[model samples]
Target: MTDQLSQLKQLTTVVADTGDFASIAQYQPEDATTNPSLILKTIEQSQYQHLATEALQFAASTLANGTQAQRIALAADKLAVLIGHQLMQQVPGYVSTEVDARLSFNSMATIEKAHQLLDLYQQQGADTSRVLIKVAATWEGIQAARVLEQQGIRCNLTLIFSFAQARASAEASAFLISPFVGRILDWYKKQQPDADFSGAQDPGVQFVRKVYQYFKQHRYPTIVMGASFRNTEEIRQLAGCDRLTISPNLLAELADSHQPVIRQLHADVPFIEVPGALTEAEFRWQMLEDPMATDKLLEGIRQFAADQQKLEELLKAV
Candidate 1:
């Protein structure tokens, strides 16, 4: 009998959500996703620091003619691109590299930073189609994605927690959206005393399911990629999602287990009302109305920013 992981792969594209390329190669996921936090964690203990050192040296040589601070920023961005380039060589599909989280709310800055990362890839002769510039799902970020999409720059709108965020991303015609599963489950569990949620009723599972149904009903081209699973059950619940970006730890568990797996989500279900585009004010108000979305989005950005800084500090120290 095939393990659950192999069976799940037959139903949906399995993306390894980590910066550790060795394990990524071990699983041979269709694609691989990386975030500020994962990159920081991986590079700290990974044998891949040589890649960062080489990128920093390249920045110092050809990337000269910038202020000291500007030089540091260039080095950091180069590190991210180099990492993405290496991972792209490993996976069959795209590798996601996130924009600076501090620019999460700034559309213009995010747009500029995004192309800058692509330019690095362009210079190295890496295929742009194998890259996804990850942006926070802020209204400004989604607007940034809209412009980038027009220029043929694909985007992965991430840190999503609510239907509003997902809807806005799809309206912007993003390449994909990563709705967090563990974080949503954490919020609801924190609120209730007994925390009885489980199976399909799990808040995180239900949230993604609702978004999946909404997209299927609308027939939107934007793909839904479930992310941040706290346990294997969440992964099992979302078996037939468009994609799932899973951690290496959970991937190892799925690789070992032969548990029964089945498609839990089907896009051909009864169609629901499709929501149209959201105005800037409407998007902000919707986030304000949903405390869980607001808190989780804020926390997610802060955590990413902090980890990026830590990665920067580590790079600088070397």
Candidate 2:
């Protein structure tokens, strides 16, 4: 019998979710994702100080003729692009570099910022084809992604929690969608004390599975990546998903044990019945109906926005 990792790979593509180089070498995931939070966390660690120093040096060199804010923005872009380039050396798949979360609500601003990030990567002789520019899954964000996709810039719609957001992204023909599994579980655990966790039934797991089945069933070409995991069980439950971007800690956990991992998602499986495109009014209504999704989406955006501000400040201090 095949090991669980191999067995799981038979059904889904596993991507690492971190900025730590050491973790990427250990699990050897096909791709990697980084955001302000992950980058901030990595900067605090003793092992990742070199990454920060390199970013600072690059920022200092390039921004020698620019303003402080411009230098900071340039630094953030350089750091993120540098990290992407380094990770690509290890993972054959694409690396997702997120846009400033502060621009999530502004469609035009997000588009311009994305182009700027892509431009920096291209300057480094990196293939833009291997890059997935990440954006929040707000309506504005999706609109920006649609524009970017038309310009041959693939996008990873992040901070997604609701089915409405997923549907909008698919309708826009986004390159990929990242539905946060752990965050969904966090919401459910707070509200539903009697939640069951048997046989692919957790709320977070169920959310990703539903989106996956919908996309597969309807032949929506958008890729669904289950991200932000809380436990190996959630990861195991989503084994057959289109892709699962896991944290290094969980990847290490998965690699250490020899357990039976079953296939939960597959292209050949029949998809469950799902509804069609929701209207703006319907989307708003559904979001209102589901308090958890509403609250979580807002909270996630706020957190990312705060992190973006802090990153800007860090660049200033550098």
Candidate 3:
């Protein structure tokens, strides 16, 4: 019998959700994703320090007249692309590089940063076509992604927690959307400490199931990638999703087990019709109504931004 990891791959595209090249090689996922947190975690290793050094060199040469803050920001961007470029070599499919989280609400700045990252990837001889610029699924972020998509750059809308965010992302023609699984479960667990949840009953698992059904029923082109899983059960429950981005620990767990992996989600599931494309007001209202979604989205952004700042500080010290 094949390991659960191998079995799951036959049903869904597996994606490694880390910046470490060694893990990417070992898991052999078709695609991989990285954000400020992952990148910060990876570069702390001594072997990966050269990427930081190289990023600083690139920044200094390119932004000689810019301020120290400007140089640090450029270095941060370069470092992310450098890590992504390396990851691209390990994966056969897309590698997602994120826009600065602080710019999540600035549509124009987000677009500009996306262009900058692509340009850096091009200069590094990385295949631009295989790269997906990751943007937060804020209304501004979605609008920026809409523009970038029109200009032929694909985007991965990250930190999605609501159906409204999903609908807006699809309506914007985003290439992909990552709805976090573990984080949703985290919020629910905090709310009900005494309650135990697992398998299909997991709130995070249920959330992705709904989004997958909506996308499939509506025949939206945007891909639904379940991410930030807490355990293999969350991953197992979301089997047959468009894609699943998993951390190395969970991937290792799946590889060790020969448990039967069943196809739990399918495109034929019953769907709830959301009226139409979400307006900014409607999007904001929906976010307001779902406290879990609202809390998680804000926390995700702040955590990413904090890690991004840490990455910059790391680069400055190098």
Candidate 4:
């Protein structure tokens, strides 16, 4: 009997949501993703210290007269790209490298940072096509993605929590959107502590299912890559999604399980109402109405930004 992980691969593309090279190698996922938190965690390990050292050295030599902040920022970017380039060696598909979460609402800044990341990748003799610049799915970030996509830079619009955000990302023609599943479940569980939120009744699972159906109904080309799963059940529920980025623990669970995995999502679902393009006001309003999404989006950005700051501080010390 094939493990659940292998069976999942038959229906959906499995992406490793980690920065650890060992985990990527162990799972043999087609693609990998990295964020401020993941990169910081991976770099703290002894085995990956050298990447940080190299990044610091590059920052020192390149920004000889730069301020401490500038040097730290460059080193952080270099570190992320170095990690991504290494990941590229392990996976045959794209490696997601996120821009500074602090620039989440700065469209031009996000685009500029993306170019810098790509340039660093190119300097390493990496194929830029194998890179996905991850941006928060803020309105500004979507605008940034629109510009980046026009320039042939594939983007992964992340921090998605609402349908408005997902639709806007697709309208921008982003290469992919990572709508978090486990995070949604977390919010609902907090609100309804005693609710029987198991199986198909899981809000996170239901949210992704709805988004997947909408995307397919509209024939949108943006890939809906479900991310941030908390358990294997959430993973199992979204089996046939366009792609799923799983953390090392969940990947291991799936790899160890022998239970039969069946496809739960499909592109042929009945079409839901397709509201025309969402205006900026309408988008903001939607987010405002959904307190869960608003809370999670803000919380996710703050967390990522905090991790980014921590990563920079580590680079400064090095």
Candidate 5:
């Protein structure tokens, strides 16, 4: 147990990136996170199918005297909160439940959805402090997070890729930030396979390091969570980050290995300094200039939005 716990601690803070309570219990990650996509995947598994039915039943009961649209919306919120509750039961740390991805671009709608998720969790006897509302790192989403954070609801800024998103999320004083390492590697691998990321020169490694450095340099309290890992190499490169939310498969891979994990990032090292605080215009310009970040951000949102719609259709069928 010491060896396992040491390995888990030496690397980034291990966060179980699944909706399955059993897996989370087995590993005992410090935290857990779920998105619409993860919830959708979990419901397809035979073992987890009960969660969906439970959600549907709860929604049905709540909406017994309400309209169809109201019932569906309430059902979605109930499902997310119930899943969050199950995860909290397995892990002692915080559990993240995302707002509907379709509301990512609408500040008011996103805020309303976030409140609905929180309300449902409270009704289930869960503490709001242990629940982080996950939202995409869109401009509007960041704004919504700003408002949510002010209202005392911690927010986890998800789908973050580039420095701009990280900067904006930190500026908003979000509770946590999940920057995708695997997706960034996927993009760069296709475009520059010959580029060496194994060394300190890896672009993906450099990107995350930069974000971590910025947060530390600015003394921002937002936690950096490296996510969406494709391979151990990316994870290895990001060792020493504040946190890393790894998939169950990757966690298994890390657990089975005995290779040495080194500390790659530290607070003492001086980070590259950027110009003074960026205005919204400057942030937008930088994101626009980086075509890759711009394209990937929009693409990620579109994919999540589509998956969200698909999940809604499934709920309606139920």
Candidate 6:
């Protein structure tokens, strides 16, 4: 068998889930994605400082002189587009640039920020199809995506854990939803250290599989992109998914190994509809009741928001 990376690509659309352009270019993933956390990771290195510098300069030049908060907001928007623009050069398909996680619960704010990010991408001479404005899978976020989709803006809903989030995203006509695998496993392992979650038995894998089946069964066009994977087994379990976005480290592992990775999840008969799409109350109640989903969702948002603040701090220092 050729390297697992190449073989897997035959069954699925492999996306590089990183902000590092060099690694993405080397792997040649079909698409590339970046969140506030990932973009902050890339900007930490001195070699990537120029991208930040460029964004700050762009912000200072284009944005009106405003309060410190306003300046930070402008700078963060620029940084997201700066990274996405660069990633677009490397990947042949779309580049996902996330909205500020701080606005995850604010539908109007999320829509506004998505436009700002998309505007920056367009200003860089890139088409709309080349970009995915990533938002959280909150009802507000999905609602924001619904409005954006009507206006021709595509969205990738992140931090999606439950099928409620998945169904709402699909109903919102989201372009994609990144169901986090590693983070799910992290939550399960912390809660149940004795449980065996290896391979197909993993909660994260099972969630993605069910969501994928639900989408394919119902003929929903929303794409399932399994993300935040922990190991090769998780990736292998989701081999035939619509897409799998792996980190550079995992991409390298797949590239180096010649494992004859076989497809696992397939479009079987779609299960019966779980229920109607979630209303805001239902969504909130479900999230509140599901401990793992609620905790991971909250944790992911806080971590991303923290990274956004750190990115702003970096802008201030430089």
lDDT of candidates 1 onward, in order: 0.90, 0.84, 0.94, 0.94, 0.83, 0.89
After superposition, which runs of candidate 6 have C-alpha atoms over 4 Å from their true positions? 268-275
Residue-by-residue lDDT tens digits, candidate 3, 17-41: 9999999889999999999999999
Q: Is candidate 1 or candidate 6 better by lDDT?
A: 1
Give the poorly placed runs of model 4, Cα more than 4 Å off: 269-275
Candidate 2 stretches greater than 4 Å from native: 1-3, 269-277
Candidate 2 lDDT, 1-318, residue by residue in tens: 655566667678989899888888987888899998888777667776676677777777977888777777778778788888888888999999999887888999999998888888888889889999999988888989999999999999998889989999998889999999989888888887787755477788999988888899888889999999888899888888889998988877777777888777677656556556667687778778978888988898889778877777766664
Model 6 Cα lDDT, one tens digit per residue, 1-318: 799999999999999989888898799999998998888899998898998788877777776667776877787888888888888888889889888899988999999888888777788898778788899998888999999999998899999998789888998899899999999999989989999999889999999998998898888889999999999889999999999999999999999999799988887674565457668898788888888888888889999999999999988998
Q: For candidate 6, what is the total of clashing residue pairs?
A: 0
Lowest-scoring 10 consecutive residues by lDDT in candidate 6?
Answer: 268-277
lDDT of 5 by residue, 1-318 (tens): 334335657656889899877778777899999988888887777787676678778888877988877777777678788889988888888999998878878999999988888888899999889999999998899999999999999999998888989999998889999988777777877788787656566566778899998888877889999888877767777778998888888877777777777778786655555446657787788888977777777888888778777777788886
Candidate 3 achieves a global lDDT of 0.94
Could you list the CA RMSD of all candidates, in the order they appear? 1.3, 2.2, 1.3, 1.1, 2.2, 1.5
Name the TM-score of candidate 2. 0.92
Highest-scoring model, TM-score: 4
TM-score of predicted structure 6: 0.96
Provide backbone clash counts, one per model.
0, 1, 0, 0, 1, 0
- Order of candidate numbers by TM-score, starting with the best: 4, 3, 1, 6, 5, 2
For candidate 1, write residues 1-318 as lDDT tens digits: 899999999988999999888899899999988888887877787587887788778778865876666666788888888888889889999899999999999999999999999999998789998899999999999999999999999999999998889999999999999999999999998899596888888899999998998889888889999999999999999999999999999999999999889999997876667665788888889999999999999999999999888877887888
Error of 6 at 125 (Å): 1.0
* Candidate 4 local Cα displacement, residue 314, angstroms: 0.9
